[model samples]
Target: MKRIIFFGLLFSFLGLKAQEQATISGELKKWHKVTLDFVGPEVSESDEFNPFFNYRLNVNFTHSESGKSYMVPGYFAADGDAANSSATSGQVWRVHFAPDEVGVWAYEVQFRKGKWVAVSDRDTPGVSGEFMDGAKGQFMIEASDKTGRDFRAKGRLDYVGGQYLQFQETKDYFLKQGPDAPENFLSYVDFDGTFHNDGHKDHLVKKWEAHLVDWKEGDPTWQGGKGKAIIGAMNYLAEKKLNSVSFLTMNIVGDDQNVFPYVDYDTYDRFDVSKLDQWEILFEHADRLGLFLHFKTMEMENQGLLDHGGVGAYTKLYYRELIARYSHHLALNWNMCEENGDWVKNHKTPPQFKYERLSMAGYFHDHDPYQHHIVIHNGNMFEDILGSNSMYTGLSIQTHHEDFHLVHPWVIEWRNKSVEAGKPWAIAVDEPGDAQHSLMPDKDDPSHDVARKNALWGGMMAGAWGLEWYFGYKHDHSDLTCEDYRSRDAFWDQCVIALDFFNSLPFWEMQPADQLIDNGNYVFAKPGEIYVVYFKTGEKSKLDLSAAQGELEGRWFNPRSGDYLKKTIKVKGGSSVELTGPKKDDDQDWTLLLTKK
Candidate 1:
């Protein structure tokens, strides 16, 4: 009888140990999201134990062959299936890691629980929670089978210096063009949140109804097809060949007050697990569609909402959660804040000083294992943040011109300024024009000639990485109410044409050399190898190729029609040559491409 009782106790202990083990899921392939789901302590989004602030989960993954190790932060997933089930309380805790190499990778889970443990110094391991705290395992990863427009096939998009972002595997340079407005994009009706019912501009929540037709049969949806419209919106952007999208992750007191990550509108420390899970679903689909995720963390108004504009507990936790959940994405940028430091000008919120900005960016730089591009949208004091010593990897330029005439020169100015500061920023004209009438609707301005010339081609020719169209509020399908992406369908075609032309060149190596042309046209060239001169108002101009030898061939490209004109010219290098546009409309914009023969 004693022996039988002892054996029963042993069996019970073995069963408990098996229940504590982690269940690894995902494709287990290179550049694929491999998730580690563990059965942790039972907790709720509203639990007094405060899972978000009092508990910390991090996993150290080390590749077997290369010895490359990454300490990835984990989060409290209310339920593993919360996106579909909307479960608020469960024992599930998860960490997602995208393995970059094809080999055996080992991981060790460090689960700690203490006072303010989530925001504590990561170097110190707090009190162990005892549930999967020291769990260790290994998994083998194979080459990704995904291809064509899938980010997994191209690998991570890394900012490897200079003006362009290059893929880790393909070594292809990326030039982004997409939408940058309707900052409340995440305030979808389908998301699990009370922001829609809250009295703060709840009506501004987006239904994205017009994009429902773009959602295919097999695309992801949460809570029984609740996310079709938003998912379909992403589909439409991808279908249009638009490669990036920007939206604010938090906008509590900002223009569109329907978006925030907390469980409640005013709650700052605690997060809504199910809502974030749903966001993850959308972000995962975006990865498959080859879309770059521009995570605009905060707007100007709410920049001072947390910790009174300081990097305190709430701010740290906010950035920590964001990095843990989304930094695994291959193509993304952590925009510190939109129109940051507006307090200096508007004096509404408290000023965010240079140290605070650096502190915030430094937090992301230290915590994020992937080290994705980090940038800040200007409000004022851009010069304060410039220099190689700073953490910012890029800039999101915003200009105040209705016609976007300043887009070209501003790109040049900042690009030169950043280089002069010993750090060259990957500049993009995110918000090109003024708030009143930038990029009017198809009904207001169907041709989009001004926007095409002064904004799109203007910034690109000035060596801007790309541009995101900001829909002005005065027009139909404005920024806040732009339900239909087709409102600016004609402009999208022009954007595609510009991207196709730029992608065909060795654009990464090319630098702006406007002095190469005698006229005041834009010149981007790879020295003697290739030169592209843009004539905003087409006319005959002289190009000085005096630095090169041998003959050169020239061709005229019609920017408006996306066509190569029959007009061609051949001229000897080491001399000034007169270049003329096609015999058609001489006043329209034209691009002259010259290549050494």
Candidate 2:
């Protein structure tokens, strides 16, 4: 009888161990997403137990060599293959980790259950779950085999105390240029959700049929090939050399009213698992294709929808899920809101005060192990949030001008103001033009001269990191309705030209030195190293090199054609030098690049 009892206890211990096993997947490489899927308690989206809010899955990943560690939050994944299976209930709890170093990574899982345990700050607020609560494992990561434009080769993009974000591994600064329109890019019909038939602006659901031709043979798709067009859209952007794409993740009650991560339009706490898994496929493809994700969490119209403009349980859960699921990506930012904090005077929505913004940012700061750069789009509170102590690391500028003239000065204004406030921001002109006709199609304004001179070069020369074109509502493929990115193909080429020129220089170390030029042009310089002078009117300008001590090689670049004039000049330092564009097209916009010789 004693021997039989001992064998029974040993069998029970083995069963418990099997239940606690975690399956690790993905490429075991540095900077690659290594996913850990655990078999935990089974729960449906509408379960009374509240899988999203009541359960917390936190995994501690530590690099064995450096002793570096990260406590990454995990979520209920629903059957472990929900993207394809579309299962509503399962025991698969998961965490995604992008390992930064090439070595052994040890991970320990801590699964807890209680009321609002997901957002709770107490160290031991809840009791441990049955399965995978203390599961532990280790994996070896090799050097990333990816190269070229794939972000896995570059590592995480970190805001390293400057006006630009740098890749952790490559130490390369990023300059983004992509489409900012059709903000409801995620409101697709292919995902497992009722939003398509919810009847809340259902007509805005995008098929992305126009980009289907861009999809390659090996690209990922879900629910038996339902995500081709959207995946193809990402391919198109990467092919065009545009490195960023912006979309509203949740736009309930906002413009278009078609995007949200919930199981239903109004379900705040419960998330649609399969739908988000499909989004992960697209976002993962974006990372592989070198596209930066601009996750505009909320827009002005629906900023008050969650917790009525406070960082309460609903808001906390919303952000927690977002960070848990998508924050592992290498190149992305948590844009707090689009046109944030506008309810101060309008009173149409509840006010999101400075404290609330800080609180939200504080949550991301504490929860996100990567500590990704956080930003807020302008509405009315940029001035109020400017300071070193402020949590925002950047600004998304929107200029409501018919012409692109304001793009330059607005970027300069905020860049200077942020610096004066003791916190320099990575400013980008996201919406350079007005709501009606910002960037017209090639059929209308094929030349795109004003946009090139005033917006593209204008913003960049003012030390703005980059610009994303917003298609005005009056034009074809407007912001809310753009399905085809080809509407602005020609303009994208212009953006590529600007990016290529800037990439060839040490732009991260340069600052806006407009005072060094006598003409009404723009100047960006690193003093004695290099100088980039933009002539908006293609006129010659006298650049002051009086503070330098060497000769500089000068080359005139035609911004329109993306070419060097071949005719180069040598200028002496310690004096002002007159610089001219190429004589062939001297009347058009040109950029003068001067490097120390």
Candidate 3:
């Protein structure tokens, strides 16, 4: 049964003639965005390209089958040929709408024209004029048949009152395993923007050389095949079974001035439509490959770079364009800032700056019909709005040590704390620290002791949704500059093993229960049925089995090789059993699994 409740704006569409001048494109599948392109007045390069000023497209789409409706907004798509053409002006204005119901979705377009048109309501008379008003059309959306890496097959990842993110289609919980470094992940050479590492904030330049060979046939690109390198990089990650990557869409005042979507870094008002379209192609490919786009919207240095600490002109347009263009993605979150709290120059962003963040995140929550997860990366303090009443639904944390045991407590704190405050917060240890040398490449740290025992297993056993390994700054592909993911293949293998371990078990129903161990070890359990324990530094212990009524069995798991090292050891109920480490790798780290027989 489908549950329907009002969120955002809902309205009925007024039908118009069967044939309109506008063109509709994209897959007609439920949750898949349908693009509506219309002809508008052509402006010259000299004319300021301001959708916020010159024009507005307010489209209301209604599901014919269920009578459900969504008032989706559209934007200015340069020439409708942005991927192949960089024309300053052409009659191509488009609106992208993701239908929630699989049926004939009818839509009506109310295109208004005026100066500063984007600043007010649809009916507000701000230098009023009518452009493509009263335009109407309908499209059929069928059920999707995408699977494997395709998020469409898996469904939308939503924050549904749990410590984990549950897939809307499968209703299964998602466990993330991916990269969190190469902060300038979007500064690809094929992208439209200027780049200067300056050898200060970053020393390594980016060309995405290693994955060039990975670009196979059928992949997309912009003008003259300019997007292969970046798209291929995503392909490589997906092939490696990694499902996520974090990149800054804008980094003007930070490390690298190479990836902003603006026509020019200094000009935030006007976007580089061609470049953004190219990005959209890559994003679509990533979605099909089952990779989550972790869009880190802002870096620490410039949290207040937009509108001088207030949410206004530039900030509004930036977020509006981002939502209008990419909110349709099936799996993603609009992270307000990377390492968020007041990283502005001189004095910090004033106390009033809190309202700006509220406004920015609130805009996405209220405007985006999809309502994707909203989170903020760590800054100097715990997020101020981690509650049920706040707009934030999750947290992207960063730490400062090689030992990730901190991962466990922090995750427990946020998850339990937020739920107590009324909403369960999905916790992801995106960056585990000592940033100078965090999760080094496989070559730099062969054992990966701290990361595996502390960060990966610790966080998961503590009910964390998942973890993303951040490359330390000391390595060749540190946080600021990473082009080749293969350098961390060994570590990636460990992550795969960890995720595989959790997926094979009913980990979702379990919670951290460390009190059952006599020795210093980690445990996650469902009390009377299933339990998992991790032994660090070859520690031994007696697992208390009093809660379990039936005879209990145990198996020793090797974190490094993803294999079972020992057969089941049965212990009588209401008794304690001594658990040992791996038979041969006795002094090394290991994990144990227990379940009632």
Extract clashing residue pairs from model 2: 182-479
**Residues 1-597 of candidate 2: C-alpha lDDT, one tens digit per residue:** 999677667647766565576788999999999999988898998899898989999999999989999999999998999999999999999999999988899998889999899989787668987689887789999999999999998999988878999999999999999988878888777777988888999998888899999999989998788899999999999999999999989988988887889998878889999989999999999999999999898888887788877788999999999999999999998988888766554765333343377777778888889999898887764887788778788988888888888888888889889989999888888888889999888888999998888899999999988898889998889988889999989999999999999999889989889999977799999998898888876566788999878898989888888999788988999999887766745577878888898
Better of 1 and 3 by TM-score: 1
Flag regions of model 3 displaced more than 4 Å: 1-21, 44-46, 121-129, 194-205, 342-355
Q: Model 3 over residues 43-104: C-alpha lDDT tens digits?
A: 54237555655666778889887899877777777778877786656667778876666878
In the range 487-545, model 1's lDDT, one tens digit per residue, is 88888889989999999999998988888887678889988889988887767788889
Q: Is candidate 2 or candidate 3 better by lDDT?
A: 2
- Backbone collisions counted per model: 0, 1, 2
Worst 10 residues of 3 by lDDT: 1-10
Worst 10-residue stretch by lDDT in candidate 2? 346-355
Task: State the weakest 10-residue window (summed lDDT) of model 1.
Answer: 346-355
Q: Predictions ranked by TM-score, top down?
A: 1, 2, 3
